[model samples]
Target: MLNKSYQQRLEHDLEGWVKNGWVDRQNTGAILADAARGSSSTKIPAIIGILGAILLAAGVVLFVSANWQEISKLTRLLLLLAAMWFTFVVTVWLKRTSHDYLLEAILFLGAAIFGANIILIAQLYHIDNHYPDGLLFWAVGTLLITLFLRSRATLVLAFCLIVSWASIEILEFAQHPFWPFLPVWLIAAGLAYWLSFRFAIHLAFLSFMAWFFSSIDLLIKWSGFSDSETGGLIVLFLLTSFIYGLVMERKNSPLSLGFGDALAHYAISGLLLIVFFFQVETIEFDGWPATLPFVILAGFAAVLVLGTFIARSQKIFNLTDTALFLGFSTWFILSWFIPALNHLWLQAAIYLGLTIWLLIFGQKQYDKLLVILALIAFGCQVFYLYMETLGTLLDTSVFFLLGGVLLISLALGLEMLRRYLERTRDPQDSRSQEVAS
Candidate 1:
């Protein structure tokens, strides 16, 4: 939902546009209505309801914990069961009343209590040997509720539970690959498609990513740590995901999605985070070698980039979009293949160049969040560079001075570009944003 301040700003700008003869005065109201429609104002009560449910659940747990010594097993079980049934009753009432969001919250609470009751009863019966199994049971039960209720909230909860279950199995029980999770993620994806919930799609993707990253050790067990740098592999994965987002976002492409922007944002954030680790120069950099995983990863990333390049409708290279990807991809692959490109100085230069590219991207796209992200990333990079490279006061002082000037210059350029873009932005584009929102 858009903030009130942002809405006010948009309204002010719309009025100016109306006065400038750029937009018809009569259409302004319709435009504002579209922008304000389906916003958080209507959803806030439902959110509060859900949050209250969660808080109530937490409080109940705390009470149970506090009275654990005093309460008998049967009484505790009965209490949890009663609470679970109570929520189900409330769910029926809300459903009859057509309070969908409240019904969802009640159902979610029931699901939580159901999961808790399972393990609690198991503990009482002395069958809670494998706690991770409890998580799986909880996830499965939640998914059943999700399926029956066709709830967005419960679907998300199920996704989280399943991921937690798989994570615990892998981390605590040495369950290799977590094979069952793949099918479960597919189920979640299918359900998301059926529901047409964009956030659920994000959760599905995240669950899959979690499964892959968590199972990396077991998936590559034969190679051992000597055969690969996990960091390099992760960076490659992120790069590939970024490219996939770009490819999927292409309007003319066969595959397109409304959620591709979110995926691209995640990949960009991951890339910047890795660059942060790079600048620190202390996050277990083993110097990627020509290993099997490296070769596979690099090849996969290359294929993605090349495939998209071949499919790109624009004959001219778009630096604003592709610059950051190309810079990082070249450095990442060449750093191992060509030793000369592996130096820290070159890496810094590449990342520095990427920061500027991201700034331009943000301005060109009229994304204030991305602009803010770029600024924060640049500031962090500078701070880390200064901290890592210490010297005599005069040398350090001069370096800081130059860095400040460079940063200020970038900021000015970003502001000027932002204004230019704002002026040139078509009325249709603003309407498109409202529709997208």
Candidate 2:
């Protein structure tokens, strides 16, 4: 009995040991397999990088060796189609890759090839005979590619294409200028904005450039100083600005508000400068007798004040107001000091009233720029009147007093209403929270 018991116990112990060993081995095998998979995954990025480099090199060679000028028109078209196909294939391959950087680099190279192909095709066919149509076709193709690949680079290319077309139109119109085409350009801008909502930030950036260039083109034409070359240069500047803004926005590590504000300011300033420069000459200064300047100044001031109020109401930072305000100030200083308008006192007064109105209404808006503009306008008004026209002060006293009283009353009423609403909402929120709890 003792011998049998010992054998049975020994067999049971050996079986338990074998089971434990099997469990450990299973776990060890799983860990080793996972490690091996990870090791293989790490190599994918390197492979993608290699492939991207090769494709980029191939694209460059193909672009240079195409002998675009020597090729027949049909041959050029065929080459363009082939280049586009290659780009599409490469883009698809990059999309399937696990490496994002490699994918981005490949997309950029593809975009370059895509743009080059269009330009070459245009050259071969002398599409300038159709003027804007050739550029428009290029824009459409690039825009379609952007939509398909969802590539930011393609979005930029589309923007460049549109701006190029618009610039050509502006130049053509300049020498034999037409009316009513401004609205068409605006439509193009709207299309760009619409595209941005569907695509990436690239479309927004491009739309901004298109709008800016259109504005500049309009300004130049309006100012009677527009030439094809100048319009082309403006288009180039618009692109440069777009690129600079994109780079700055991307590079900002901590993402300060100031950088974004500055960029917005730059864009707005560019747009306003274009508008003011174009319209300044046609303002009918002699007939209006200072009315035009006052109107212009007030228009900008109103835009600033209203824009601030809307921005505050929306609870977002909107630099449009600041842009318009700065633009107006620039025009005021330039127009006032350089040409030295008659009845500058009235213009200065109008500007001051508008500024004071903003300060009182927009005090709660948290925008430092708006407040500064108000102060500047006030100081300019006081200085101009006190130094330049002492007699006009007496005449304008009633106007200033009435304007100030109205603005102050409106500001106080609005503030009181806002406080009341906040106080009422706070109690309600607390009660809801208490009930939920």
Candidate 3:
């Protein structure tokens, strides 16, 4: 499937070709129409179909629920099997008839039916094993279907089941790492590899991120810590290390797929967002996390950083990236000793600094989107800092007067800067294949 970046780039390139007179003006529409016809990644129709499928699945489930007492248990079991198989047969027929659009939605519906069958079957038999096992069964079954069909839609279905299963299992069973989750996630990743699906690979990346954060949450709890803030910092540091590995490895699909440096883009944006959320004061922690998890996670980060430095370091991830993360981790790590560094204002300051650095870096990289977002983040952090100050100094009217003026100027400046950057980074700047979009 063509990615959104490639889709937009293709449109831009087609226009450029027409302008250069390499293609006939009248033929441009036909060419683009042909391209659109071939591209399977178009979301609108698929999204609509998936929504319809969900509603259809829901209707079937609701119908079953509404008449459960009227039917025998055997009838209920057969009804579910028939519904699941009907969707699968439809998918196969769609494939054979070359109906690509509806094929995905049918496959999605089949997976949904199969998933519902797990629960319905359990209730029918009155079997009383751990119910998360039902979700686990659904996950494995959907994963197999995904692999067999090499369907991105079913891969998504599999991932949804995995996440739902983990959520239930973790919340029900106390901090049990849910270690079986690892193999299921790995299988999902393998499906991406098997099909060479770029979007599926991104789903894999997200799956890993969820598992990483959940595992860290459990680790913090096991170490006898309840402090949410400290755990956030630790997760950020470890995540940075993970991102470093992703950047250094430079994983990509086949050249035909046109997936370049997407991991780096996601990693960079992810780090910025993580740091930005750190300053939000709504979440409170009881106390600091135990030193053991912090030290162990830091050491794990050190090993990753060190390995990257050893293996063609600057070629992929550079010195500045290392230094920035080092500074970020050091701030919270030292808070354990100094305590003063843990102030909200100080956290906001560092996030502001990081925002500024990102703007400068994006300027150098010619990533207009990055610069625009960084400007927004910078303005937000400033506002957050001002609000924090207001909470303490509400008795002094003078502070609010000054803050009002500063905030108005900041807001106007941010809007102007973002619009200017967007105008400048238009069709000309988007000519690069590196994906300015």
Candidate 4:
């Protein structure tokens, strides 16, 4: 039955193919029969072997001549170009005679040529662009080739180009005076992500790496470090590796999620940390009012929370949302405890009230986490107030009041979640029983 339905859908899609003169309805049956027979496509490994042998031969020659001081850079570049051109011509010919594997071989050759050309040009000109022009050009060229050849190898090359560009740009930003180029690298990374989604290859790892590097660079800059400084580079690397592991588990590649999540997380964390630490010192030391940091932190925390929830709902579960939530929660608690906010009790009450509202609305959908976080937060607020001995009786009274209200709210919230789960499960059990019967 499922196969029949799939065939119907295929026939429906192919109806347009007949209209466009791509295929005919009368030949659809034959095409389907041929497809069912499973046409034997050429594997990529065969072409890889052939191209690998040729490249290895060339590499040996290049390595043998490495000690030759008389070899001009231009001569080396020309030789590289000649080799690439020859490979291209041969691969194209093989594509005509052989199969898809030849196309993949050509794409691999194109990528090597692209990188070699960039290094050669950099050496010949004695100039470092400090931007990802090489990677950009290679990615564009590889993307074109992928489109023309319809080869996954070319697409993978494009993915690698974007990932490499992101990594290089981040390193450049950290070690050179090239902060301005970061946005361009981010845009390129975004384009790579969009392409991956279209092609369905799951390059999330690449995207994550790009974002992770960019974010760390920005964090260092925001922390008042010079662009060329190497203070937080190690931390960035470690954090990137940790996050990369998480991203790889969820995405096919770390680059697949693009750099947006990492960008957001770093930006929010840096901004919050700056406000919490440096901003107040800078303002107060300069004889400015201390209230400025509070206002700035409050506004920033609000925006971060709003943005994080929006991203979470949109299913963007990268590190950014997690960081934003943490930042906002910390900011909220600190703001209440700070010397500026005299109405800590009132603010705690209001927060508890809002949390209860969220639990009530969210629990019906089995959102236990929301209610659980709210409950934990309520407990913390009460504990914080209890610890501070500013009118102990008054503080203890407020704590008990908030705690009682939260406990009651949690009981109701759990009941709602229980009912929702029961309602959802009953239908599944009934269906199972019906199937068994």
Sort by TM-score, top down from the best: 1, 3, 2, 4
Per-model root-mean-square deviation over C-alphas? 5.8, 18.4, 7.4, 13.1
Against the hidden reference, what TM-scores do the models get?
0.76, 0.43, 0.67, 0.41
Cα lDDT tens digits for candidate 1, 114-168 = 8778767766677747787788788888888888878877888888888888888
Model 2 residue 422 distance off true place after TM-score fit, in angstroms: 14
Tens digits of per-residue lDDT for model 2, 183-300? 4345444454445433333344445555555565556566544242343234234323422433344445243222444444354345334433432233332222144445544554
C-alpha local distance difference test of each model: 0.73, 0.52, 0.70, 0.53
Winner by lDDT between candidate 4 and candidate 3: 3
The TM-score leader among the candidates is: 1
Task: Please give the lDDT score at residue 377 for candidate 3.
Answer: 84
In model 1, the number of clashes is 0
**Model 4: residues >4 Å from true position, as ranges?**
1-78, 90-98, 118-177, 197-437
- Which lDDT tens digits does candidate 3 get at residues 223-284? 56656545555545545544454444454335324334455456666665665665464445
Looking at model 2, how many pairs of residues clash? 0
Clashes of 4: 17
Q: How close is candidate 4 to the true structure, as a TM-score?
A: 0.41
